[model samples]
Target: MNIKNRLTKLEQIIRPQQTPLVMIKFEDDWSPEQQQQIDAAEAQGRMILKVVFVGGKQDDNA
Candidate 1:
């Protein structure tokens, strides 16, 4: 299946009212083009993207 179809299926399983923590990992050396694509996907509002960078240490509050 295509990405849009897969995303739609995921959205059906996860309603808007419900908030879930989502993490997307990318290589530290990701190219600018790759970053732009990620930004564009976020702009589409198809899903929620939370960008958090942690180096070894974890956030206890979470």
Candidate 2:
């Protein structure tokens, strides 16, 4: 699915009190331009963006 569709699906599964974090895993190197885009999107408003990095396992007991 596309990014928008994936995001919508995530929203449907997530609850009001639950906060879902988006982790952008990059295998290769990342450029400053790409980082700027992510930053701009996150600076919009609360619940507008929830990005985080996950190394291995994730907890879903929140």
Candidate 3:
């Protein structure tokens, strides 16, 4: 109701979150091994974040 109370609530609710922007560049020199590594990382991320694949489906084999 008061400014001080609102500021306190905001401070409690507005904690910083670390968001990772994971990416892989598929170049002409890319290999299956690199893809495998990316897949493993993405699989781990799926457990931590509710990742959704809009362009293509996630590798079930990962």
Best by TM-score: 1
Candidate 3 local lDDT, 1-62, one digit each (tens): 99999988897689543355344445544368765655776665532232334468789999
* Candidate 3, pairs of clashing residues: none
lDDT of 1 by residue, 2-61 (tens): 999999989888965434335455656546865676676667654556565658978899
Q: What's the best-to-worst order under lDDT? A: 1, 3, 2
Worst 10 residues of 2 by lDDT: 15-24
Give me the displacement of residue 35 in model 1, in angstroms. 0.5
Runs in model 3 lying further than 4 Å from the true structure? 1-26, 46-62
Give the Cα lDDT of each candidate. 0.64, 0.56, 0.58
Where does model 2 exceed 4 Å of error?
Answer: 1-27, 45-62
Per-model tally of clashing residue pairs: 0, 0, 0
Higher-ranked by lDDT: 2 or 3: 3
Give TM-scores for every candidate, taking all chains together and pairing residue i with residue i: 0.30, 0.28, 0.29
Candidate 3 CA-lDDT value: 0.58
Q: For model 1, name the residue pairs that clash.
A: none
State the lDDT of candidate 2 residue by residue for 1-62, as single tens digits. Answer: 89999988888688343343343546454457656655665675324343445477778885
Better of 2 and 3 by TM-score: 3
